[model samples]
Target: MPYAPKHPCTYPGCATLVDAGNGRCERHRIQERRELDRQRGSPAARGYGSRWRKARREFLRQSPLCAQCYVLGILRAATVVDHVIPHKGDSKLFWNQSNWQSLCKRCHDKKTVQDGRWK
Candidate 1:
């Protein structure tokens, strides 16, 4: 099979040619990922440390079915513990068990988009 033509790296002034599948060159790709990670901070820094993990495990064990799926007459196994309300750096809200819901990945992703958190 013939390969797709190579294209210039889409990182500003760099003219390095890369495969069509990659928008940026390898170097630029690494740089972009590092920048994103720096801006995003570590999971612990965002308050999902050991305490959150233990609480999440217990919550999932007690509520094994997706809340949204249950509402829709489905019985999907839940994998994510989502905040009913966005914490947005509020420690009190972040640790509120009453504001938590068990959700499957699909339902959780949909809810995240609806909550304007994925954009």
Candidate 2:
């Protein structure tokens, strides 16, 4: 099967050709991730510690399909457990199982963008 064609990195002034689906070259990707991490703080600081990991795993096991996609009549496998309402550092809200929903990466990203959580 033919692979997707390479394209220039999306980083401004970067002429590096990267595989399709990647917006930035490897170096820029690392730089961008580091910058994001610096701005967002560590996962543990953001309430995503071992406990969150365990809960996420159990939730995903119980709800394997993306809730948003399922509502749209699709059966996409979920890889993310999203909080229906932004917790905004509220531990009670963060831990509320009723506020959680399974979502695939694409749906999660779209929701994040819509929620103004992604920069």
Off by over 4 Å in 2: 1-33
Give the C-alpha miss distance for residue 117 in model 2, angstroms: 1.3
Candidate 1 lDDT tens digits, 5-114: 99999999999999988899999999988888899899999999999999999999999999999999999999999999999989999999999999999999999999
1-119, model 2: which lDDT tens digit per residue? 99999999999999999998889999999999799889889999999999999999999999999999999999999999999999999999999999999999999999999999765
Q: Which ten residues in a row have the lowest lDDT in candidate 2?
A: 110-119
User: Whose TM-score is greatest here?
Assistant: 1
Q: Tell me which residue pairs clash in candidate 1.
A: none
Distance from true location, Cα of 34 in model 2, Å: 3.6
Give the whole-model CA lDDT for all candidates, comma-separated: 0.95, 0.96
